[model samples]
Target: MSDKEELYCIPSRYRKTENLHIVFWLVKDLCWVMLWKPLGLIMIIPTLGAALLITWQTRAIKSELLHNVAVVFWITANAYWMLSEFYSTDDSLRYYAVIPFSLGIITIGYYYLGLFSKKVR
Candidate 1:
């Protein structure tokens, strides 16, 4: 598909998401908190906390961009978590929780990146 078409196209599930664009934007607000949580002593609890925050932000946002980011993050995290838990038996198990939380960081990072990415500047 053409880039323009891809940009304009809306999915059936996201038709309702447009109303939440601002709340979705708020997900970026927790980037530092997410990063610090993983490094703290009680890692598992922080991991769960990050996941819950992302889940909450996804539900709170109405924008298609935010929805897409949230859905993609959720799917990727769950897949990795399941694979690590069932398929791998290594020291990297903590990543199953950490990587998912990283998505929120990425989402926030994107907001800043995209701000400069626009040609109008």
Candidate 2:
């Protein structure tokens, strides 16, 4: 197999960094969904950390550029949501926030489709 092909192949064992990445995101998302009210908008701290760590983990992958961009949008969306929750009552800001969130999701979908789809075999 070519180096590029090998690089794209899924690893047999999950790396510690990868596991941490998953755990971080899980905590982040759960906190955002469940604890946001009690946490009083401070939840973005851990979520931002999770996003940064996930972006760091993607650096080892072949599709790092796409992953990084997606993470950026994800972080931006989270920030917008947090800001709207804590500070902004502007309805327009809420509507604008969807753009980055949707873009982030779409980029992640594209990355998975392009690199990890079963059809790629």
Best-fitting candidate, scored by TM-score: 2
| C-alpha local distance difference test of each model | 0.50, 0.66
The 10-residue segment with the lowest total lDDT in model 2: 6-15
lDDT of 2 by residue, 6-116 (tens): 445434343554566556556556656664554535555665665666566566774775777787787778667756655666767766789998998898899888777
Clashing residue pairs in candidate 1 are 17-62, 20-61, 20-62, 20-63, 21-62, 21-63
Question: Best by lDDT, which number?
Answer: 2
**Candidate 2: where is the Cα deviation over 4 Å?**
1-38, 64-72, 109-121
- Candidate 1 Cα outliers beyond 4 Å, as residue runs: 1-62, 94-97, 108-121
What TM value does model 1 have?
0.35
lDDT of 1 by residue, 28-69 (tens): 324324533332223333343444444554554434356456
lDDT computed for candidate 1: 0.50
- Candidate 1, residue 79: Cα displacement in angstroms equals 0.8
